[model samples]
Target: MEDLAIARACAEFADDKKAENIRILDLRGLSPVIDYFVLCSATSAPQLRAVRDNIEDEMKEKHGQRPLYKDGNYESQWLIIDYGNVMVHVLTPEKREYYALEELWGDAPEVALKSDEPAPEPKPRAKKVAAKKPAAKKAATKRATKKKAD
Candidate 1:
């Protein structure tokens, strides 16, 4: 699979495990070492393990891709799955906040996920009108009536 596809697949697998704040960074031109980075946050150790394992298993089974190197553990609150061209990071909320990979790789553009359905259109905002004082109201009403008569 391509680097972006692999990164997206890893993100999908992580989402399958209810991973939070999932993001895919496009480092194609920015980084010479890696093409993409898939980052996600898990609430607890069990969830961390689930997100990591699911990504690994699904990638291997569906895409026939396996990580070239893997590091960290659930207890450490962070895990790295290195796929040579793509790197997947599964981290706990605290560790993710501490590391701040997004800020560190600030130059890398984020990849938008593909959605099956179209995005909902934004609702129009209501226009605000200033309250008219009693004198202004009378004058405005008289002008409107005068215009109608004319």
Candidate 2:
């Protein structure tokens, strides 16, 4: 699979494990080494492990691809999976905020993930009912207005 496809697949795997703030950054022309970066956040250690393992397993099974190197355990609150052209970073919310990878690589354009499912239909809007003025009040206001005009 191509680098972008692999990155998107990794993102999908992370999403399956409920990873938050998942992002795929296209670094083709901006970066010298990497073509893409898949960034995601997991809430806890177990979730971090799940995100990492899911991506690894799915990539291997579906695409016959494996990370060339894996770094950092779940305890560290940050994990890196290095494929040749793409790098996946699974981090905790705190670590992700601290590192600020998106801001660091600000020049790299983000790749929008296309969902296979169709867009959800919008909910019908509730009809608004206009409040009516009392007949007595309306007549009083009309008389006051007529007096002012005279």
**lDDT: which candidate is best?**
2
lDDT of 1 at 44: 94
lDDT of 1: 0.86
- lDDT accuracy of residue 116 in candidate 2: 51
lDDT, model 2, position 10: 93
Residue 69 miss distance in model 1 (angstroms): 0.6
Model 1, position 72, has a per-residue lDDT of 99
lDDT of 2: 0.87
User: Candidate 2 residues 15-121, lDDT tens each?
Assistant: 99999999988776666678889999999999999999999999999999989999998789999999998999999999999999999989777787654532233
Task: Name model 2 segments beyond 4 Å from true.
Answer: 115-150
The parts of candidate 1 lying over 4 Å away from their true place are: 115-150
Per-model clash counts, in order, read 0, 0
Which residue pairs clash within candidate 2? Answer: none
